[model samples]
Target chain A: MTIKNFLYVNRKAPYGTIYALESLEVVLIGAAFDQDVSLAFLDDGVFQLTKGQNTDGIGVKNFSPTFRALGDYDVTKLYVEAESLAERGLTADDLQEVMYEDEDDDWAEKPSIKIISRAEMADVMAGADVVLSF
Target chain B: MKFGVVVSEGPYTHQAVDSAYLFVKAALDAGHEVPRVFFYHDGVNVSTRLSIPPQDERNIQQNWTALAKGHGIDLVVCIAAAQRRGLLDENEATRQGKDANNIAEGFRISGLGQLIEMGIQTDRLVTFGD
Candidate 1:
């Protein structure tokens, strides 16, 4: 049988080579095939979702804007690692105006985008039919 | 099976290498074939033979070397990315007027075509980057 559920883990920054962007594209492709899909961001991967990313200084277009379109691809289960954000001195407020607050709130109930600790992440990975980390 | 690997992070001081190694081992153990392991941007460093890690730490280059030697896996380094980073084969090293080549054996220096090929042949493509 075709893999029913796929988990895509993105661990890169938003700019530079298209690793983050391209991984999201692959997730969308999987979703289009009628597969259950989710995404987890870790390490610098959390930076990809941060708000107010200024890429113009580097002579590159700001790619963070595209992240807002993920919902259209049916990729709603966005996750961020709590430790990575803290290490980078970034709170949910520092990110683009998404539901990042729920991400940092460990006590929040049924938050749209939850920030999970590394230990809590194992179950998320264990449940996927295929797990792709990028 | 379909496989897609997106390696975006550089090879130095990063978990991208370790993560990719674990995933590849798991995939192979699960009896899945990795059709494409795309090394983009800084990931092209895995193809270099000039890496010299601290003696105490595990050499990332050697891990890749062992993977290739044991499995006969196809390791393709992005040509454009490698050129940008000055990673070249023995022939390209000479042609580019460089003193030496650092691309290790068992790794082919190729282009994005290899990625597209993997997408076509495998059931899934797992990426390791950043």
Candidate 2:
């Protein structure tokens, strides 16, 4: 099959609901195929990338650590909407530093989360061949 | 155009399955191809044969089963999600050492690759969720 752009739009928070974790499972599984896969963190989805998510008290599995493993899966484009972060009173500092090894750039480590404007996020959405929301 | 659908919510708790079923029906009536419908999260619960609702209300699982049988569409419930929520087919039940299985007719347990494949192969991918 031809490689298609699979944009996974995450709009929910990490723990309070199951959408975030469910979406992550799809992303990890989708990485097995030969396709252009990317993730968009908007709304409360940005919370999925925040650091030190301890879920022991809530009795839920903390799957936030799995985001770091995305880089190993070669699914690295993580677009975080700037407006979403601002609206939630979160800055880039509030996000976890997920890094990927740039294969073409001498295998250098680079940040996966690209904080972009709302306009750019819209363009990213429009340019996708298939947009999967969760 | 070919359409791919995802039902991510359960039957009565949310209207996602209903809306997706209706959308698929409308698409088929208009002579469009709907090859697959992937069920994830609580949506996987839609594949249980044991779900008995009020006699007056609509039978959600049966509707999907019949529609899939007529159209030869794939009704895939994610294995990971199914396992977590205790929704199992006979084979899965056997493999997992369970006594019984509740997978409805015309539905199968599969992986998320099917969902990704649907996105790649179909002209459009539609999601019905909360």
Top-scoring candidate (DockQ)? 2
- Summarize candidate 2's per-residue lDDT along A1-134 as a digit string, tens digits: 69999999999999888999989988988888979998999998988988888999999999888899999999889999999999999999998889999999999999999999999999999999999898
Chain A vs. native, model 2, TM-score: 0.97
lDDT (Cα, tens digit) per residue for candidate 1, span A67-124: 6666556566777888988999988877664432233357343333678888777788
Clashes of each: 13, 0
| Whole-structure CA lDDT of model 1 | 0.71
lDDT by residue (tens digit), candidate 1, B1-130: 5456666667766788779877887877897766556776678887787888889977777887788677767788877678878899987888889998888877878865565455445666666654
After superposition, the stretches of candidate 2 with alpha carbons farther than 4 Å from their true spots are none
TM-score of 1: 0.53
Candidate 2 chain A lDDT trough over 10 residues, lowest sum: A25-34
Give the Cα error of residue B70 in candidate 2, in Å: 1.0
